[model samples]
Target: MAEKGDFKHEHMADEANDNDTVDFSNNISARIKNPLAGIRQDVLLRDVEEFAAMYDLSDITPLLKKGALVAQNPADFENVEGLDDTERDVLRDEVVHKWRQPRALYTTVILCSVGAAVQGWDQTGSNGANLSFPVAFGIGDTDPTSPNYTRDLWLVGLINAAPYIASAFIGCWLSDPLNNYFGRRGTIFFSAIFCLLSVIGSACTQNWWELFICRLLLGIGMGSKASTVPIYAAENVPALIRGGLVMSWQMWTAFGIFLGTCANLAVYNTGAISWRLQLGSAFIPAVPLVIGIYFCPESPRWLMKKGRYSQAYKSLLRLRNHPIQAARDLYYVHAQLLIEHKIIGQTNYAQRILELFTIPRVRRATLASFTVMIAQQMCGINIIAFYSSSVFQQAGATVLHSLLASFGFGLVNFVFAFPAVWTIDTFGRRALLLFTFPNMAWTLLAAGLCFLIPKDSSAHLACVALFIYMFAAFYSPGEGPVPFTYSAEVFPLSHREVGMAWAVATCLFWASVLSITWPRMVAAMTPTGAFGFYCALNLIAFTMIFFWVPETKQRTLEELDYVFAVPTGKHMKYHMTKSAPFFFKRYIAMNKNATLEPLYRFDNVQSDAVRSASVTAYNQEHRKSETTKKLNL
Candidate 1:
């Protein structure tokens, strides 16, 4: 009714108002939006009432209301009415002192740690047995002149690769169903049984094929347990300390490797039965895992997914310090789940697996998960983890000295992993990967080049061991802790089990390839060539990570949905254009005043309608600018 330009300007101003509500521009600092942020008080109360009624929680409805309010705005817990001093103090501790968690939570972490140790022990068991078993089975091929050398090398590699073959092809794939039916604790217990029986069977096998079969059986346990334990730990811990707590999987796994080396050294002199004991001693870690898993509470998110809200509330009680904290987490997670269900929709197991590639949000997480998991293998840690003894022997050490050096490598691996507990959440996951990969690459190359030194020279073995130890030192704090922790936390809960299975399978598959080919590779390429090959791979892994992996420190599992929702192209462009230049200016050019703008805006308390309107307004403003420029031209 007004002049045409005036009407147009009025419409644009409305759109601009909408844009202001949900600024999706690159200038905004990224944050995880609170799921319950913008709901009306009455609406939230009604939802809580319905939730309590459905879950038989009306007995605690008043508590539930208080919990819901706190969950909606955790920062204002001090202002939450009806909260006592003790409850307020506990909430304060969660922020001011995050490490002061319930003892039950630590106990659960310990159990998962034992499960990880079993995995590490299984690997080194085969490692130590490698020196003796091939000869015992009539396939020793150390000499190049032997007519059966090639065949024996291939066979030895196959035996060494047996568990990973089974893991990659069979075990990892079974996690979803096992988790769906048996629950986390039950799945771990089942895997522990398999690990225990297989280690004992491996020790008793009379021939190569028998031992191979036992190790293959062991893979089933390794794959499933590896897939489940990190997820178990991630789900149980608070988001603030999730990385440090979950990384205990890698930390204790290193401990297990050290313990396995000790066992290998202890039984080195046992007449004719040394390899047998080395293989069987791995069962020790499995025993505790089999028994202790039941003592840990099942994951509350998983329980919530199954619609066992009452049970989830109970489980949360064990993990958190106070009843209010448990209720708040349970309610918040439930609210997030409601949004997740609306976004992801219901799908069958196969559909969920397909969604790993099909859904845009989920597929980003899949790519990121794959990047980190495969990077773990590409960084070449397992080559040393699986064959340090053989590598040391090749460096001209006597058998005992080789074993001792492998023990030293194990010690360095375990000792250096401690720093990641503090750094992973602070320096962050992506930063750790970027920093360590280059260091690992150079150190690994140096270790391999040391092989060129004259074997008669005393410095040859020392030089190789020194570089290898340095590589482990770099590896332990970064790639060692990040892969499992990142993979476990990245996916939405709807697809968590299958997503973790996919990630673990990718890791074990490549691990199998490395194990099966290294003996042949080392024989053909020499130590220098093989190490150099993986050294180049470390650089390639670093590049892939720089572009593909997103930083995911201190983000809750539910909140990660928004993080991954950023398209891969946008994420890649931001790093390539923005992050890369910032790094160059700040570090290379030594710029004192360089400031890198954040790529994503945080809409923590914004409603969907507000965000949508904000986008509309931003687009309208962009169009108006373009029109103005066109007119001027």
Candidate 2:
């Protein structure tokens, strides 16, 4: 009997060994076949209750503790390496995918559309108001050489600069904190309220100062949108489709500018209805945006990162069609935070912005983003946008003619920006920046010379107009979207909002200075001199892009850190994977698509800790099984 029992025990031991061998073989084989596959393998949803329970006792315990995934154990803890492989995998999965789907991309589009429309309305509203302001304010007819003309132009310049200046400082303050505090939808709601107040104030303004104040108030909302919209999009989308989604906002912004131009033309032609209707019409676009954003899902990341994992999971399920996918994504996000040693509550507002500049890698990214934003502003694009009508009028076009020309410029901007939206992922940042700068500089220089030439000659006027068209077309791809996209990309996931705010604030600062100064500069230098100055500034920017700007076209946010934050040796040759016929190897490098996947979904199962609270869910499911058993009985 003893011998028989020993034999049976040995047989059981052998079976256990065989099972272990099978599992190990499968795991090893999977790793061998695809090395990078495991990076995102955790994105697949599994049984959350089982995973959480298993992970609580395993290697991932340390990480769960670090990510605040598991509450701080009162007991002393072991290191992450101490956990066994399966437990570690569970913990890793917990960190990567969220339990919820992202807010619908369509929802994001609608929310951000308000911000973009605000940008357009402000740009065009001010443009239109500036066009008619001299007459509206009773300053007198605009003659470029007249002192009255210059003063009146400066007042118009103030109106254009007001929103930008206010947005620069105020936008930063409102965007990151409000996003954290109120959540994305709430922040957008407040922005809508601010915008509403701004519009109402503007409509009722009796004087220039009041109008300026109203514009300033409106700008706070606009600035908030500018900073938050892209951040919201980046946080909500998956890594696969990020570029297209973010740039779509830029596309709509350009579209808004186009619409604004059209509005300006209609108002200008209508006589007395001009400035009032033009400024008032600014409120139209944002109304839909506000309504859309109100109904959109919250950012799951913001919630999860804040230790509200259940809420994050629910948000994710709403964003994605597949519940498992959403859970998987949440796990990945947590995993990344664990690897980086980032804890959400540990970081406050100031710390977030400070962290962006304090880290070496982050500092490099800051510099790159800062330089790029500054370059975008100094490239003379806003100069044209803010003062295009004034510029055309000075070059000898009639007021009505200049308004038409401005509309034409907006049309060009709207048309050409579409290619940028499509190709930003395919062609890349380096290629676009490389080609755009020289084209704009040369064009601006030529246009400057045209202004310097005798104004009486139609040839000079034709040349100036031709260059303006070229400038707008070339600008469509780079300046219009790059500043916005780069700001979203440069910072780490945690620091995105504040870091973006800082960068955008800087842009607004420079924009304010430029918008305010350009009119006076034009008055002092004449159109020829102002254009020449811009041409020279752009030439310097061209040099910077060639030497400094890294190609970030399709890189994941993490991958982008390597290019921007990591330092390369001066003479080291940068090799990029070029997927091609091997012909364009020198000019083309491997650029990844900057697409982000959706981050919100519904029905994603969270941790067992949270799942236990969901008795209604299980009860509902068990009801059918119970009914079947009772019938059988």
**How does residue 146 of candidate 2 score in lDDT?**
78
Which ten contiguous residues of candidate 2 have the minimum total lDDT? 28-37
lDDT of each: 0.85, 0.63
**Which prediction has the highest TM-score against the true structure?**
1
Which 10 consecutive positions of candidate 1 have the poorest summed lDDT? 1-10
In candidate 1, what are the lDDT values of residues 292-335, reduced to their tens digit?
Answer: 88788899988888778788889999999999988888888877
**Model 1 segments more than 4 A misplaced:** 1-31, 605-633
> Would you estimate the TM-scores of all the predictions?
0.91, 0.74
Q: Among these predicted structures, which one has the highest lDDT? A: 1
lDDT of 2 by residue, 1-633 (tens): 111011111222232233322121112211111111122212212222333443332333333333222221101112322345454333333323322234475566545755686676667667767766657666644677776787776776677788888889796578988887787778777777777668767866777778889989987987787777777777776544566567777788788788888888776767765777777777877777667676687887677556566567668777754444454455545443432332222467878777776765566667667777888887898877777887788788888878888888888988998787656766766567767888898888888888876878987667888899899899888767776776777676666778878887888889888988887798688777888898888889876665555556544454343344335322012322221223243335433433322211111122222333344335655998899999999
